[model samples]
Target: MENQAFQIGKASLLTKQSMGEPKQLTSSIVILVLATNIVYISNMLNLVTYLHDRMHADIASSSTMVTNFVGATCAFALLGGFLSDSYISRFKTMLIFGPIEFLGLASLALQAHLPSLQPPKCDTVNEWNSCKKMSNLDASILYLSLYTVALGEGCLRSSMASFGGDQFDENDPIESQQKSSFFNWYTFDKSLGGLLGLIFIVRIENNKGWDYGFGVSALVILFGLVSVASSFSFYRIQRPRGSPLTRLLQVIVAAFKKRKLSLPENTDDLHQLDIKEETFGMEVLSHASGLEFLDKAAISHGSTGAWSLSTVSQVEETKIIIRMLPIFLSSLSCYICNPLLVIFTVQQGNTMNTKLGKIHISPTSLVIIPLTFQIIFLVLYDSLFTPFARKFIGYRTGITQLQRISVGIISMSLGMCVAALVERKRKRVA
Candidate 1:
């Protein structure tokens, strides 16, 4: 009887172990992410044209609207991240938001399909001046649908990445190393999804109709939601780690309240979690130097435990975020290229001969050329460039993260310069 009981317990443990493996969790997540990107990028790539051609908006107005929409969608990720870490789990966030995304896409598809929702066709070439303006009702529906999609996207993006990372047990060195590889594959999947959307879905919208294209997007998201749901049992869900914002704020408030306190001489005097065995246990970060002012928060005051004291780890987390602020701000500059490239490329396509043999390609579809190049370049960088750089520099990791970021910034600048030169030439020819 004792031997049988032990065998049953061992079997249960093995089952649980197999269920939480990265392979089982990551496959479902990649599918969901790929589907979501296909829907998102397909709609976004044609949004400017949708506004100008379907809604009869002017060039400047359409461009501004697209820019504002993109900015709002990107900004919503912060709110999503905060909510995921504070109140709800990442799994719950995605589950709730996925349907909201579907509703938004469905609304857009319905509006496109129904005749009453759209304005009458205009003679864009000859009677361009006499084009009818969009009704308030139509405008309202358009804005509502677009912003709803943005909100859903905001809720999903940050949480999804963190959620994927949570599947791996970071305590295991092998699993921890796989986390970086998971991120690389995640990015690759995103790029591939976007490329497919640009090449196929955008082309369908251009030739077939907006309704069909949006309908495809709506269906893809529905499939994604279903795919995610199927993996519910396998996912290693993490509980909310109390609000990070609240913790950061606590550090600030504590530091301010104890402004007159004297600093301790030895770092050991500071309050910190009693963590044992740094290698396999809770990470025990060393005392960071530069932020001397914030370190006062860690000074133990008489037993009132509220705002009077914090752990060294908490103080260091705040300092790390503060230090990273500059890099985050610099990264925002990379987005400036999107509006320039999308808006101008479409305009150039309109004027230039887009015929290749028998097919008449859409100007917006031309954006895929650069996307294709990006995919090829990523492969070369990973396969050819990294090994060469590692051999030359004697660095085990090839190049540091900061150096890679610098290279990206330089590459973006050169691309923008080339775009400007092309635009100049096109204008001269006209």
Candidate 2:
């Protein structure tokens, strides 16, 4: 009965489009992001080491497994977003995926603790050549747990930022500014959690055991789930916005079905909704010239329409998304290149000095150096730089999203060059 009432209340909130208060945001999305980063970053950053040292896998095998796991997690984000927009609301998506992540973490902790569940650990690195490698059963269990976590993490991430941003209304200039600053600080909180994960959790895994480290991570996620659940009333549960996939498919189907018909000459001939009468707040996109084939989708054929007809707004929206594909594909180069650099650097750092007096630092923990800088940079960018730059740039958040992506690509190439030079210096010094 209580659960039923809670569900009803959530449904009401969904319809209302309630804006989350600051206190509610702190307990829910803030904790969710922070907890997620801490648990995931700590585990994934040292996953290769765990596979090689504890699971007794070769370096190449360990790296491959880690890379694939990372990639799987990213891919799951697409599925999650689709589910959120199409069927279940984003809040519900988070609720469902959060527990799945917890189960994965718990299972991993169990596997790490029990020697019977693990392969025979090599006594020395040199012994790996003669070692049998991780048993099939052990490897299967590891994969299951890792992918389970990946699915949950990916889905959760798909909704997390969007959910958080929805809390602040963009209509009010103040709330709009808060929304911009909110993401920056949200990232800072997440980075701070990751920094702790690297410095503290990694050390625990190194000094104590993977079991203990994973156990703590599981507990943190559990707390995060509870936090999200407890803050249920405070959340602004948005109604499911119709899926982009469905819309795109509709456009394609409409276009194909109407392929035999000739297109109307005037851009205004394309079917469009009366903005004042139909659309409330939605932006009615202007019909763009490029994808004229898609314009067939917006053709008003007979007196009636179903899947074979679409509005100009719908067709234009699909066209815009299609146009962005090139930029999206181009961005993949950074993801492909940067990950290899990160994995290689972690391997290299393992051979470097990791001690500060009595404290023995885990090589994986060295990531906190970059994370620390990131946190500081975010603070300065949001508090100092963005406002200062807004004076000249004439845009919110200092620049467009496209400009940011371009800058990220440039930075990725620079980082690779710097890393190559640094690796040479380290080799010569050694």
Candidate 3:
């Protein structure tokens, strides 16, 4: 009887664990689908290159216009974050903002067809020259459309990330681990979107027209909206964390009142500490005064390190700066490499193919190759390499975003070196 009871209990535990996997997978799939669509449309390299190559806009000018999209999106992300944390539910936020991205795609398509729709004032010059050399009105409209797209997509990105996280019960260890794994898959799907957009969608756009490319983006956005909507039944709704302002104030107050703040010396003490004290503890009050005094003292000393933060914060900042330096230097090389892919491909299609026996290739197709490699690496590292490294090194095994990002940087650097070698080979042949 005792053995039978134990078996029943074991089976019950196994069933519960098995049930969680589907719940986790469903939520993750929603995130993955949305992530894929977002990346595909946002990083459409051919579209950017098309403007630069055909429009006679210099790299700097074209990049600035592209940067405007990023800026607009970032601003919306801040707004979205505030709303998600305060008044709005993550589900509603995603549902509301996701469709706005489709409007951006529609606007882009309109801008492409605008010249034919509206007769130009300078018909003499415009009729003779290409639309690229036409009046700036078309360009302005095109850019504005892109900015609107960015704003809507940015809000969706912010809300969805939080919403995906909210699906898991954080208190459950197994569920938390499942959620962490979901993020890896989430990133993988996004990379897949970027790869396809770079390789397939961009080529379709370039071959067909800007309108076609924007149309594809509209389709992707629709799919994303559908995926998000379907997950409504699966999602376990969560309350927002409130605004950053409130969180910040809580931190400051907690920091200043350290003396009154009692810590759990033991589990029993935790209960005692939870109870509100009638008066502010004198020791905590003194500690607060000491902190203020330290700030004043550090200010008088005119020290760079002083008056900023405590030792822990300073060390953390130093570590962050150190990590950021390599990425910053690498970013310069990345900027140069990014444009070369499109420029070379487009030039080959237009000029080199005419003179040499070179075949015309789509600019977007070149972007796809690198992103495919990135996706492969992302998965391999997450599923295989990271675990292997952890086992051998006996290091802490878990998601380390910093480490993953550093690996990407290294891969990008190697890619640049290979590109340089390829450039040298082409020059030698020439």
- In order, candidate lDDTs are 0.78, 0.81, 0.55
- What is the C-alpha lDDT profile of model 2 across 110-198, one tens digit per residue? 99999888976667476757666667888889889999999999999899888777666565566677787888888898889889788
Candidate 3 lDDT tens digits, 273-390: 1114411110111112122322222111122322222222222223344456777776666555554554454443332333224654554455556667768977887789767876
Sort order, TM-score high to low: 1, 2, 3
TM-score, predicted candidate 3 vs. hidden true structure: 0.65
lDDT of 3: 0.55
Superpose all Cα atoms of candidate 1 onto the true structure and report the RMSD in Å to 1 decimal: 4.8
Go through the candidates in order and give the C-alpha RMSD of each one to the true structure: 4.8, 4.4, 9.6
Determine which window of 10 residues in candidate 2 has minimal summed lDDT. 1-10
Residues 53-74 of candidate 1: C-alpha lDDT, one tens digit per residue? 8888887888888877777788
Full candidate order by lDDT, most accurate first: 2, 1, 3
User: What lDDT score goes with residue 258 in model 3?
Assistant: 42
lDDT of 3 at 113: 56
Prediction 2 TM-score vs. true: 0.88
What shift in Å separates residue 9 of candidate 3 from its native position after superposition?
A: 32
In model 3, where do residues sit more than 4 Å from their true spots?
Answer: 1-43, 52-60, 117-137, 249-360, 386-402, 409-430
